[model samples]
Target chain A: MQERLYSAPGCTSEERFGEASAAGETLGERMRRSLEQDIARGDLAPGARLDEKEIAERFGVSRTPVREAFRLLAANGLVELRGRQGAIVREIGVNQLLEMFQVMAELEGLCARLAARRITPAQRAMMSDIHARLEAMGEENDPARFYQINLEFHEVIYEASRNDFLAEQTRSLRNRVGAYRLRVTYLPERVRHTLKEHAEVMEAIFAHDAERAHAAMRAHLTLLGDDLIDFIAQFGKE
Target chain B: MQERLYSAPGCTSEERFGEASAAGETLGERMRRSLEQDIARGDLAPGARLDEKEIAERFGVSRTPVREAFRLLAANGLVELRGRQGAIVREIGVNQLLEMFQVMAELEGLCARLAARRITPAQRAMMSDIHARLEAMGEENDPARFYQINLEFHEVIYEASRNDFLAEQTRSLRNRVGAYRLRVTYLPERVRHTLKEHAEVMEAIFAHDAERAHAAMRAHLTLLGDDLIDFIAQFGKE
Candidate 1:
């Protein structure tokens, strides 16, 4: 994955070299992480074939670990393993992506609904703090930092829902679409829109308005989905 | 797996012998199906250790297939593979079950909402047809058959959503909590309530009222979850 960092224009050379030297992870784990990150970043395009021998050689490891990593990726819906052809990154078509977003909207809405009713004072405060941090990132036009903080903001709500299973499922679904979602986050208008949406969700939860919280969260996700579709239509052509 | 059938008084001796003679499925596939059914029926019991050697002997198959079946069950979240301790029927505590039901309600509601908006005339007719069959089963007071048909009825709505990904995820989550759901389906009153709830959802869809359809489905699932918890508390004493 560090090797692929050089391909990403956003990363500084110093950062790339620093990451290259970090090698604490096991071979199979590193392979899995690298493959996942590449797929998520569209560095490795959808439907691209991943030859085990090629990946092994690139990572300077044996084919055995690469095969194991493929299994992990397959289990996570990141790749498809063809019998004779080996592995290819799973291609989520527009319709499927829309379907996923629809489900994701509902899941996030459910979390906000529960969080509104069940969130403690401390959790509510944490949400406010995260919201403030997000606003600061937005003002600075730092999408990269804002994107990371945006995840933390959502994580607070997931935790506030107080349902471990629901939180885990929601997070898993989020990860499934994480790659496509990353593209939308780079837009300045989207960052501004997200700040307002987050504020509405936080206010509803603070007021313990479950229905309002649910509606706000649903609206936020629906807008995000629409934005992604629009982005894909206009920018994806290139 | 066949040996466990003898312990279920619901099965006739003739039926048991008939099943014993059937051999179309591969050993591993048969074992997987049998174990899945047993878990869904609660015959295997939560937290019960699945000794591969014992299960292999009982199913008259080698441990290799039994091991393969374990992998299948683990993938489906039916069993947990604790390190060194081997496999155990996954124990979904009360909190986890509630969380699952909450998410299930949202997923079902999302399906109903989409089905209401996007269902074709043919799909609406199919839903009405399934509802009629469900009503007949309810009148006959056949809980077992009602349970089976009930699944078909919900499946119609899932497909009508026109989102394969959402439908598949909803079905997977349903299967995850199926064992507990089976218990609630046995109650005569619960069956009647389900009939009424199905009518509401079908009516809403037929009317093309997305909000109503969503609300009806969510209410139905929420009621089912509450009833399951109540039943577990009162009758699970044994």
Candidate 2:
């Protein structure tokens, strides 16, 4: 069996990543998170079968809850249900990944544009604070920490948009794509380019220029030209 | 109680509104469509309680499927499951509606932009055909027909974007908002304005002007300033 899934992926950091968070979260949900983390970390490869009896015994649970957990996983697109073959980790096609990336770029751009127009003083300070931390990284490339912090930087903009529904949708999309991206290591040169682009987005938002913020953020994240070609190559290996 | 829900809301017109469609659709799914249509038409008003036994009797089904259907409704945001009290139709807040509208506009704009860049001759012809139908309506105002055709016009662009995932998401958003918009009647004046706006979108797409197509489509559909004000007033009435 796979794992249970959250309908709303993440409204906050605690809901998203905390191992033992969200009061009243069911046992199935916790197990689901453990399995989800395993999948994201590539411990469970794509197309790998999640045997019901095996997983149930491994997790020290009965088949009933395990079956329910597999249903949840299927709902989350983490697993595909085959008639008699139980559940298998979904193999995401490159076309679908590309489509997701394109949508994510536009949604991020909208968040940036909204943040430029609607950010509060505290939100502005938070953005600047994150910006400074990223800039402080200099030439040192740490993919793990960079990935974590990059998410924080984006989350700030999503929160600043002042639209919970919009933010929730964006976060759900982010969670869906996160597994694929987790497999890719950030290169030193790519990190350098990303730092420069972050500055461009930050400057636009600081000046309260919505159009510029939208354009700048789109440029920063859009996988086009060489970036897209590089992603396809990396994706094939994953 | 309530109705079952489709996870992927309307990947096509047939899946969205057809009574006899989608081969092998479950009995619960069929009942769901009837109830969903009832809700959309205001026959089942917002905040209405859906009694499990009563609904089961009405649909000539057992309590088991009724409960399963209610769960599906809750998942789709069509109903709220309140502990042991059973399910009630969900009440959407004004702020949430506005947020959804804003997101929908941007998604449609992205479709238009991509359509301009990637549209084939066949897609271009289809867009022209829909545009002609819309223009032919002229001052002969029919809100129901206009709304139906307007969706077709937008769907054409969505298809032309050549991204199935993006198109599917856009369609899902359209379905979510359809219930709310179903209550509003387009005045003759609004129809004239729609015609003018559609012409602008059509012209931009015909010329392969991606930026203009994006901006024009946003302008066409965005609920901003006066349009938003009017919508809020109308929404309150609904």
Candidate 3:
């Protein structure tokens, strides 16, 4: 069943980009999105100074939009705007990274707790469907596909909480830690463990057991943080 | 004891203002601080439109600095920037308010948990002193003094966590909800209940019991949210 779903041509990254363009996003918004993707993908390293002139020239645009993008990025905690040094990709220190994961665990746990109580039947069904897809991706040992599906799975819980402010904050925090977290997805056995953990969270939510769902989500995130710290301890060697 | 401390005129609001002026803060930073105080004190009501020209003239500064102040306010989630209408004090809906409290509870709980494990002796002594002051304020039936002391009590825990990012984020969230929360602090019996709750949290932290501290802080904040909701439902009367 999972294989069939994976075989189908679903919404690819390119399609998402196309949709954004079709929606008539501003130049600054588009530049911000592109720059964010580059940073998250490690194409731009932490502490890399972003020159407005260089970025504008590279993108064949003026510096105004690039500067605007920097402001947007800085607002989201993605970049730091220095007085004369311009904008640099902000680095998360080890302590900060651990602290972020601690907060992320609580936020996600809160989402699961709320979702268990407030999720509509349709939303629960949607989560189950995504969970199934995630399991399939795990079985196929495709970390890349699993990572994307895993994000959608968590996003559904955020929406199910029916709290726009909470959802936005969670999404922003997730993005701030995304670059560091993305590497952890490639670790062996991680996908399998993640699949099991998602199952527990899904089952608890389906049963409307808020406490169980919260605990499951918190434990999952805590373990992920432990794994991430271990991976970093290995000097990020594959 | 708390009466003696309160009578000392320690760091009164006027003195704080004098200190800021003495520090020679930037015009934009000063403007941002002034606007934040207005909003937090309800001097500037929710959804009130802020005009750049008016603010600049009132502060005897240029429109350039006023615009910068607006950006800072927007970044802190205290104001909304509407292109043509300028900046407006953001009105947080009831649901969003509840959600913010939920997240705030978790963040503070995490701080307490970390503080239990990491707090230095000096930090612990400071928290104990603040907690004692809070109890005295409660006995004197001085909610106003209790309110100020209560903030310092939590600040001690945030600092004890030794996580700069987490501390900063927690402080920002607390400020975001401070305006709504201030009214609830005035409710009859609230100060007494809050004093007891602080004692439990302080005792747990002092004992180095991480789980107990976490639970105590969470329960305290959850009750605070419940009281706020009930207080608001009465239309904030009496």
The order by descending DockQ is 2, 1, 3
B204: Cα error in model 2, Å:
1.1
lDDT of 1 by residue, B8-75 (tens): 43653223323753444445556776788777766677878899888776666678668766766776
* Candidate 2 lDDT, B75-137, residue by residue in tens: 456777776676787787777777888888889899999999999999889888998998888
| Separate DockQ for every predicted complex | 0.39, 0.41, 0.38
Which order, best to worst by TM-score?
3, 1, 2
Where is model 1 chain A poorest over a 10-residue stretch in terms of lDDT?
A1-10
Candidate 1 residue pairs in clash (backbone atoms < 3 Å): none
Better of 1 and 2 by DockQ: 2
The lDDT-based order of candidates, best leading, equals 1, 3, 2
- Show where candidate 2 strays beyond 4 Å: A1-38, A51-78, A81-86, A138-141, A224-228, A234-238, B1-43, B56-76, B82-85, B138-141, B224-228, B234-238
| Candidate 3's TM-score | 0.86
Error of 2 at B92 (Å): 1.6
> Per-residue lDDT for A92-156 in model 1, tens only?
88878888999999999999999999999999889989998878765686655776799999999
Candidate 3 on B94-121: residue-level lDDT in tens?
7788889988998999899999999999
